[model samples]
Target: MYELKTKENDSSVIEFIENVDSPKKREDAYKLLDIFTETTGCQAKMWGPSIIGFGSYHYKYESGHEGDAPLVGFSPRKAKISLYFATGDTKREELLKDFGKHTTGKACVYINKVADIDVDVLKALIHQSVAFLRETYPNQ
Candidate 1:
């Protein structure tokens, strides 16, 4: 099995975002990063090569696999921004209804542009996701 990397470096995260080719995309990345950090009250850092993740939660399943992951986070992908929020039992449509124009796949909420979505709605989703993760994975 492939193990998820747990270590994070904020400087590397910034450098990665800065290297993005589009100025608008770069700006949007930082905007999303700021919102996630502010709403979750958790520091943000890069996960792997692309994801800007927030906070950390450790979890172990019944099958005895255990690992740590970001409690809430998002990645600015080429086609759309992916917000990772599904800890299961998410009120996804309720959140997305307020999020303006966007799409979704599995647990990720995909946004084509930051301007396409209401910033306040995005912040609320981040907060809600973090709260859900905390509730679901508490002490686990």
Candidate 2:
């Protein structure tokens, strides 16, 4: 059986932020923490070693692979911050159009810092991502 490597753990989100090497990145991480927390109305949890996540849902694939993942999350990486959101969400694409300076991948929206993006748009992304996951998976 294949297991997900990035499962949630009991690590301290603040501790993780403190250990981040870059001072500016550390500050950005705290800001993201606050944004995600306030926007989602969910407390931040450490996902794997690096990703700070909020809320969660379980998903079972058609292939029978199943796992629990955060509704919305972000990582303060060395080069840039990586925001995690539901993949294949059309609304997400629409919001990204006004999300300010950012790059996209299948599941991650990369941003240099919080100031580089509009916080309101980011909140919309969080709300939409959480709503989409809940509607799609329907599993707590």
RMSD of 1: 1.9
lDDT: worst 10-residue window of model 2 = 105-114
Which regions of candidate 1 fall more than 4 Å away from where they truly are?
Answer: 5-11
Residue lDDT tens for model 2, 33-99: 9889999999999999999999999988899999999999999999899999999889999999999
lDDT of each: 0.80, 0.93
Best by lDDT: 2
**Candidate 2 TM-score to native:** 0.97
Clash count for each candidate, listed in order shown: 0, 0
- What digit string (tens of lDDT, one per residue) describes model 1 on residues 1-140? 85766445565778888888788888999998888888988878777778788888887889988887787788777877888885575575687888899887877888888899999888878777778778888884
lDDT of 2: 0.93
lDDT of model 2, residue 18: 100
